[model samples]
Target: MNDGAPQGWGAQSTDGVRLQKVLANAGVASRRVAEDLIVAGRVRVNGEVVTELGSRIDPENDLVDVDGTAVQLDQSKRYVMLNKPTGVVSSMKDDRGRPDLRRFTQDWDERLYNVGRLDAETSGLLVLTNDGELAHVLAHPSFGVTKVYIAKVDGRVTPQTVQKLVRGVDLEDGPIAADKARLLSASTGSATGREESLVELTLHSGRNRIVRRMMAAVGHPVVELVRRQFGPLHLGTLPAGRARELTKVERGALLTLARSATSSTPAEDAPDTRDGDPSAE
Candidate 1:
C-alpha cells in the first residue's frame, strides 16, 4: 500500500498511489486511462517502465514519468451520480463498441468512473466519482452498502417466494438472501388477468446478476430489474438517464451508513424494492 517506493527505494509515507491513481495523479488521464497505460507498457517506474496493473508507487521519490513527461499529481477530488438508464454500460470506456457514460461527463474537468456496476439491461442509481478511496470502500463487500432494487417478475408471486427470499435462498454465490423482501402489490395481467406481482428486494452483497437470479430461484424469473437506492442515497425523482451530484447531506449519509453498518439501520427516503409503482419517465 505504500506508494512511495518502487524497488531500491526507502519506505516512506509518500502518499502511496494505486497504480491507476498514480497514472491519473500524473495527469496521464483518468484513472481508467492510467490503468491502460500500466497495461500497455507506457508507464515507467524508476528507470524501468512497468506494464503491470497491480503495481503501486509512492508519489515522492518514485520516479514515475508517463510518455516521456514528468506528471504532477492533481489534488482536487470530484464525485457524481447518474440515474443510469438501460443501454448504458457502467464503464469509463467500452471496448465492446457501445455508447459510454463518458460522453455525458465531457463537461467536467476531472476524470470519473462508476463506483459500482449496473447491468446493461438494468437501470437506476449509480455513483460516479474520482475519489478512488471512497469508491473502493463503498463497493467493498465488507462495508456492505445496501442496494435496493424493484424487480418486475414474469408471473404472480407466491407468498412462499417472498418468505423464501426473506429467509434466504441459495444461489451460486452461496446462501444468497435479501436483507428484506416483501410484496408491494400484485395485480392480474392487464390483458389476460393472469397473476403478476411486484416485489421489493434489498441486500448488501454485490454479486453479478444477483436480483434476477434470486427471483428465478423462487420460480419467478425477473422480467426487468431497477435499482432504487444504494445505501442512504436514492434515485428519488431523478429521471432515467439523468444525473445529479451527491448533496452534502447525501454524501454524509453514505459515509455514516458505511461506518455504522448493522441491523436496524434506517432507510433513506428513497424507494424500496416494491412493484406497482409507476415507471419513472
Candidate 2:
C-alpha cells in the first residue's frame, strides 16, 4: 500500500487555505497553472491530495511543491518606450545586415526588447520594455491597445471610403475594421496639383500589416504609413531617428492601461488628456 499525503496540508493547518494560491506559494507554478494542478488532482493538503478549486493554504505554515519545482511571484519590473524610426528592424537580432533597435540603446544595461514590432518600412512610436508581464499584456490581442496611424494614399478619396473603413470590412482574416477613421485633408502642392489623400485611422487590434491591408482593401493602397500614437502615448513633435525614455507619469499611465486590458474594465473616469508635459528624451 502506497499512500503519499497531499502536498500543502501538513500536520499544522491554517484557518484559511486556498488550494491554488497554496500551490503558487509553494512555487509549484504561476497562479493559473497552480489552479490547473489542483484541478488535475495533483495537489495534496495535509496528507489528502485535493482537486478542489477553492483550496487555500497559509504560506507561513503550509508545505507546498509542484512537481518538485518551487515557484515564486516575480518582483522587479521594467518599462521603456522608443520612438522607432524607419529602416530600423524590430527584431532583437536579425540574420540579415539590417540594424535592429538594440543597436540604438547599446548603453542601456537593463535587458529590454521591443514590446511589439514595427516593420522595417513603418516608422514612429514603438514601445520597448523589460517587464515580461507588461510585455505579455501589450502583445496579447485581448488588450486592444489602440494604435493610431497617419497614412497617405494614392489618388483622391471620397467620404464614402472613410465610412466603409469605420463600418468594418471583410478581410481574409474575417471581418476586421478600424475603430475610427477620418479624412484629415486633401491637398496638392505646386502648379502640377498632384493630390494625395491624408487619412487617419485608429484601431485597437495590432495585426500584421493591418493598417496597410485595410487601406489596400478599400482600394486606397497606402503609399506611406506613419504611426502617430499608441494608446496614451504619442509621437508628438519628436522627429524621426530620435529615441526617448518614458517619464514616470507616462509609465504609470501605461501600466494602468495594461492593467485595464487584463481586467476587461474601462479606464477609470478621467478627463481625456494628452502631453501633460514631455518627460525626457
Candidate 3:
C-alpha cells in the first residue's frame, strides 16, 4: 500500500489544485472563504481578476493576490461538497449540541468551513472548504452569487403571488426580492381541501431567513425548503448528507463564468464603494 498519503494542493495532478485551496494554504482564508474572495473579484492570479470558484493556478510560477495583497501558499487544502441534511446547523460546531456539519465530514479529516449556510430546517447543497476568502464574497450580497431554492408552501400559490415575490417584499430588516420566481408543476392533490404548491425562487441576497420570510409575506407559508443550486454547482442526485469533490468540468465552467462576469461589468458598475474598498474580513 502507498500508505494513503494525500497529494499536495499543487502537485500537478490536473491543472494544479483549486484556486480556493491555494488561498486557504496561503493563510488568506479557508477554502470556502477563498471562493468568496475570488467570486467577489478580489483575488488575482498572474495579474488578472479571477472570480471563478472552480479555477486553478500553478503555484510554481503564478502570482496570487487578495485585495491587492499577495498570498503565500502552503501545502494542504481541501474542498468538499456536502448534501446537508435537515435539523443541522450550517456551522462546523453547534454550541447547543444540535446536529452540525462536522458529523458528516469526520471521514475527510479536514477543517472545512461552510460556504453559504442553510438554516437548520432547510437542507440541500452545502460547500465546505479551508478557503475562507472565497467563502466571504459568496455569502456577501455585493457579489450577487445566485442561489436557487425550491419551497413547498401551504397555500394555492397563484401567478399573482409569484409576481409579487419577483417584484419585492418589505421585510423587517429591509426590502428584499427574488431575481426570478416561478411555480413548478401544478399537481392537483387532495390534502385538507387546500392545494400545496411548489415554487422555485432565485435570489442574490444572503439575508437571514430571507426565503421563508418572503413566501410568508405573500400568504403562502413555506412548509419545506431546499436549495437546489448555488452559482455553477447544482445539487444533482448526490444523495442527502453525502459529500463529494467537484468534478473537473464543473470547476472549469465556474471559472469561465466568473471570468466572464468580471469582464462584462466595469468597476464603476459597483456602488459608491467603488473607490477605496474595505478589507474583506
Candidate 4:
C-alpha cells in the first residue's frame, strides 16, 4: 500500500484543499492533531494511506476514512431519525390533506426525506436525510437493508408459523419470507375477547405492508405494527413523534453500511424503489 502522498503535493493547486485543514474543518481533530494522525498513518484518502504532510485533496470528490470509518466531508449533509407516529404519512406533504412528515422536519433548514416509508399505520425508526446517494442505496430492495418489526396480531402465532415465515410463503406479488421470526408474547384481549400475539420479524424486503400481509397469510392478521430497527439504526427510547440528529458514532456506522452496499453493487444497477408502493411498509 502506498503510504506516501500523491505526486504534485508541492505544487499550488486551485481545486485541492489541504489535507489537515480538511480534517480539521470536518471536526476530525484539531489541525495539529490531524497532522499527527496523518503521520501515524491513520488517515486514508481514496483508499490510499496518505501520510506525507501538505497533501491536498478535493473534499467534494475524494473519499476519506479515519480509523477505517468513512468520513462525511460535506457539512451540509443531515441525518435524522424520526419515531413516526401512526396516522402520519411518510411523505413531506400529503396530497389528500392528511398528516405528513413536515411536522417532524420543519426545524431543519436542509430539505430531508424519509429513507423508506413505514406507511400511515405503521410507525418506528424512520430515517430522514438529505444524502441522496445513501438514501437511494438504503431504500432499494435490492440492497437488502434489514429491518426489524414488532407486530401485534390477531390469534396466537405458533413456532410452526414462524418456521413457515422463514421457509417462505407465496404472496400475491410473489414468494416472500422473513429473514427471521419469533413469537415474543401472546395474550387475550380483555374487552374483545380475542387472542393476540406479539411477534417480531426481521426482513430485508422493502415490500409495502409486508409484515401485515405475511402475518395474514399465516392466519394471524396484524392489529398493530412498529419498526424497531433499520440497518444499524435503532429506535431506542426516542418518544413517538420526535426526531433527533444522529450522533457522530451512529453517523459513521450508517455511512459505513451505505458505503459497503454501494461498493458491492453499483447504485445505477439497482432501481430506487423507496418511493414505490411496496416500500411504504
- Top-lDDT candidate index: 4
- TM-score winner between candidates 2 and 3: 3
Model 2 lDDT tens row, 1-281: 01234344433544466667655553446889877887886765433566767655555434333443222223233455576777777767677978887765665677666666777778888777666656666555556778889988876778999999999988897888789999998777345467778999998775678888888888888777888887788888877877767764566567556654655643333221111111111
lDDT of 3: 0.70
What is the lDDT, from 0 to 100, of the residue 129 in candidate 2? Answer: 66
Instruction: In angstroms, give how far residue 44 of model 2 lies from its true place.
Output: 35
Record all residue pairs in model 1 with backbone atoms less than 3 Å apart, i.e. clashing: 3-16, 3-57, 3-58, 4-58, 44-49, 156-195, 200-273
Q: Over all chains combined, what TM-score does candidate 1 have?
A: 0.64
Q: What lDDT does the true structure give each of the candidates?
A: 0.68, 0.65, 0.70, 0.84
- Model 1 lDDT per residue over 1-281, tens place: 12333553322324356767766654558988888877887876654677767676666546555654444333455556788889887666778888668876776787777777777788988877775555655665566678899988878787788999989889875988799998888887687566778899988776777888888989888777889988778889998878777774565565445334422243233211111011121
Candidate 4 total steric clashes: 1
> lDDT per residue, candidate 4, 178-228, as tens digits?
999999999998877999999999998977788989999999998989999
Arranged by TM-score with the best first, the candidates are 4, 3, 2, 1
Candidate 3 lDDT, 142-232, residue by residue in tens: 6677889999888788899899999898988788889999999555556666678999999887677888999998988888899988788
Better of 3 and 4 by TM-score: 4
TM value for model 4: 0.90
**What lDDT does model 4 reach?**
0.84
Compared with the true structure, model 2 gives a TM-score of 0.65
